[model samples]
Target: MSYSATDMIFDSEGYHQDFLIDLYEKLLKPRLVEEKMLILLRQGKVSKWFSGIGQEAIAVGVTSILQEDEYILPMHRNLGVFTTRNVPLHRLFSQWQGKINGFTKGRDRSFHFGTHEYKIIGMISHLGPQLGVADGIALAHKLQNEKKLTAVFSGEGGTSEGDFHEALNIAAVWDLPVLFCIENNAYGLSTPTSEQYRCEHLADRAKGYGMESHIIDGNNILEIHQKLSNIANDVRENPRPVLIEFKTFRMRGHEEASGTAYVPDEDLAHWRERDPIVRFEQHLLDRGILNWDWAEHIKCKIKQEIEAHLAIASEDRLPEFDETIELNDVFKVTENQYFEISGEISEIRFIDAISDALRLSMRKHPNLVLMGQDIAEYGGVFKITKGFVEEFGKDRVRNTPICESGIIEVAAGLSIKGMKAVVEMQFADFVSSGFNPIVNYLAKFHYRWGQNADVVIRMPCGAGVGAGPFHSQSNESWFTKVPGLKVVYPSNPVDAKALLIAAINDPNPVLYFEHKALYRTQRQEVPFDYYTTEIGKASLLKEGTILTIISYGAALQEALKIIEEEKIDYIDVLDLRTLQPLDTISIFASARKTGKVIILTEDSLFGSIASEISAQITENCFEFLDAPVIRVGSLETPIPFASILETNYLPYQRFREKLKELIEY
Candidate 1:
């Protein structure tokens, strides 16, 4: 009497007997597949497996009830999620075998890959980050008025992460449609819940955030399916975040290799007696819906299917070690369509130029969103967005809570669904708070799964405002070494507006560094209309034959001032607008032309962008050089009060002196 999944039905007594068998079959797939993988692990046919023996009910029950349009973020243990989604069995086997056709193309192993085709994103090795990404997708659903929701699963231990708290708070405050599922499988790796948290239940803390919370029996398939169906439906319709704690126990080791010796004999026996799959099977038998012979036949059919797929996966090809693939997979660079700024040409301040660019971008891309701390009515700390909220309204111009990590992940989430997001950090120094998602999540996500998270982070960097240690720092160099992240900085107002607009149009994540000192101090004839400066291209400020001054941001302004005030000619000034994908062609040509070079930067002299430029010149243009490259930068210490002490610490303090020495060398 068992029917197909399409015919499954739920009534007051939970799923009807016919559909109950269907749910039972769904639960059996993960259990049987995990059992087969354990044998494969021992036989050296597979690398690793995270068993979900006792917790199959949670993944199967929740995923089975979810609509096909809804998205889900599943942890490694949730094989049932994939099986329920009907992802090809051969592909699942291929994924575990690290085949080229696998989701990550053998670049990653186990369940660390995501495919948009399935609407199922796998978790990173870092457990709690995906919760925030889920929030991003749900936020997109809410803004578009779509009746779609996203469900994300984490272990009982993952709730202890700062990301978990931050994601929940952001979701609740925004009233996003997200189902936060926590499967309490008792142990986090080796440690138990006793050492994880003091809260009676993770769900109990959700009410404090004004979010709905519930607890369920994770081992009961019927109860879990019934509760999740209603809860998922309510949240999907009303669009609010809900946290559900499903109580279960880890029946196997975290992985097969980790023995269960730590789990006392009595506890192991206790949970084994209440195994989710076993209980569900017994329930079918008691209801006279399934007999012992039919149950054995079902298990046999699952085993045969697993073995057949494993054999096919064994024949799947491995990815070749192509040198270009390593470089190419990091980012997908697209040729930008140049926009002509024919509106007006007026002298604009650096801050106004950035403001103008964002204003125009918002008007152009209706999906463009701005997120930061106190950026809405306060118009940001710099007042660059002073009238933005009134013009664009609050939804587009958002003032986020002080959760920098959450802010970045939410933007990442927004980017996943074809929306543009710009995240503003209060200060460049505070990027450390949100560095994980930027480097690990946003940066490598494309490399791992061929997905583009198109978001821009505007970093207000540099010293000289008397903002002191915490607020003042030139930290743009930090992201330059990270692949899949574009770094751009502009010297003056014209270039600042151009570069900001250009970064927004790029298909990858970009970090736009705005120097605090140059915000109001520098003014130039910037286009009032729309235009973009090309990334990875250097602008020649002044062309000369004697020598070249290589710099960017505030440092370039200081170099130009020295040349004009001192009445020096015969010097080439090149402002490198983009830091990553450095304009080496321009630098090499300039170095080869003059046979002398001076690399100036606001970051400290040692291990700075200056150091990188100097190395490139020495290696690529050694024969043409007449003088060793001289570099000037801030003294290696925390930025101090912008008094005489600060002046001495800045690169300008020695620009004139260094220029004189280098010119005569």
Candidate 2:
């Protein structure tokens, strides 16, 4: 079944000469367009240009074998894939020009645009996160038993990223139908391949993950097409992952802004001699498939088309300043129908209540899925998902690799397909590993592009168990600063169960912070029925007129205990459930009534949630304030492992003393 280069060109029965000529012409278009973009770059019409001059053949050849229904998560250099996907020439030009008619509507000017209609995902600037997203898409297809595969493209440099390894491991373990193609251009920006990785070949790394691998000459389009065609078929049928490495070179620098000074002359000269476009053209001419005149005609026609599209796109209007208004739809949650339960209300621990909420949600919505490390059979590190695998099976309740970034990426992809995913972060501190996707992609997708990502990322936060810095950290402030994200932290079991139900049904991304200290400590009578507590709403735990005290998560428990133990009848307590969309109405009402306020949190004092609340109260309730607003937070040092040290770090006695001062003032 093997065919040589001569067999592909000369044997009419195996390969049609006309199809090769057409593909050659198609490949020429992206190169010409890229060259034209360089011209526009010099003329000050375009802001930046990331050239794909030397890698068009791989893009076109791989995309040619893909069906229209299949998806490709393409990077900035894969212009040929966009062209083959039927993306209009004028739209591409409009995007470069930052016009309103562009894919991002002038919000972004690079290749960060994708249409759901085209089944292509426009990549973010981050390199390897998309591989994990592709894994989720492939998982969706596998779950539905569809005969579709997902193709994700990256460079050899991306292979060095943690996300790359995590994604490959997940794909191999889950047997997902994904084609990971790496363009080995020998450089990651300015670093050479030798400095970037020590491996002999990028595809060789696939063996460690138990996946199939292939290495191909990128300049040979016929060979690439043939291999992809056969491999893609096998992947579609058998539902497993495959890795393909395309050995190519970058003729241009990373961008036009970065010239060829860093690259050696000898290397550039050697690669120029084997230019893919030139080599393909010579091959066509030698085989009599294309004449000199016909090739020239094709180039001229493509140039004219590029010019026409450029002219039209240049005249397209730019986005207005008024259109930059902040969008709040991403924080909006849908109201789910509440079902009543006649049975007696049961008092349960915070962790068990959360698990019951998840089980109820899964039973109500068939599309709801739970994914995390040790969450399947072992039922998570805290056993929040204990017995879920037995009840819902492995397909619905899944265990994932220890990849924080990959978990978020997969959840994002699942949300795109209208499925809800609940992600369990083993510890809140580990969220730093996945911070890029949560802040950049998941937080911005709804605002920039109108895509709703219905995902819940459960973060087990706060320090009361003496787990030390790595295991015990309250990281809610990191996400509260980000727009288009909902931050929820509950103080009691009732709100924990209700808010989790609401977060799962929400249309946007939600960061649900469950306090590790309160997981088994706090028990309350929780409703057994499926219900949703309103997001962006705070619960007024105790109402009073003296000093107003606001807190959330584990600290709220301390605040409540201090108020009752001290018999402070005039002090009010407010459990601020959602942080980002702060309950300003209730906060201001309490602040105005008390004329004094105190904010409490388990995070460090600097840049803490308490600081934000204090500032907002000073701004709006300044006239009503009789005393300066005060904030009580954990010490600036990391949470210590020693029980006494940790207790002193966030001592409830300090908070009690601070509240007495505010009340007396």
**Model 1: residues with Cα > 4 Å off, grouped in runs:** 1-14
Q: Which pairs of residues collide in candidate 2?
A: none
Per-residue lDDT of candidate 2, residues 472-579 (tens digit): 998899989998888999999989998998888777899999998899999998877777788889988888788888999889999888888998886778999989
- State the local distance difference test value for candidate 2: 0.86
Per-prediction TM-score, please? 0.97, 0.96
lDDT of 1 by residue, 100-129 (tens): 878888888888988888889889888888
What is the C-alpha RMSD, rounded to one decimal, of candidate 1?
3.7
Which residue pairs show collisions in model 1? none
**What is each predicted model's overall lDDT from 0 to 1?**
0.88, 0.86
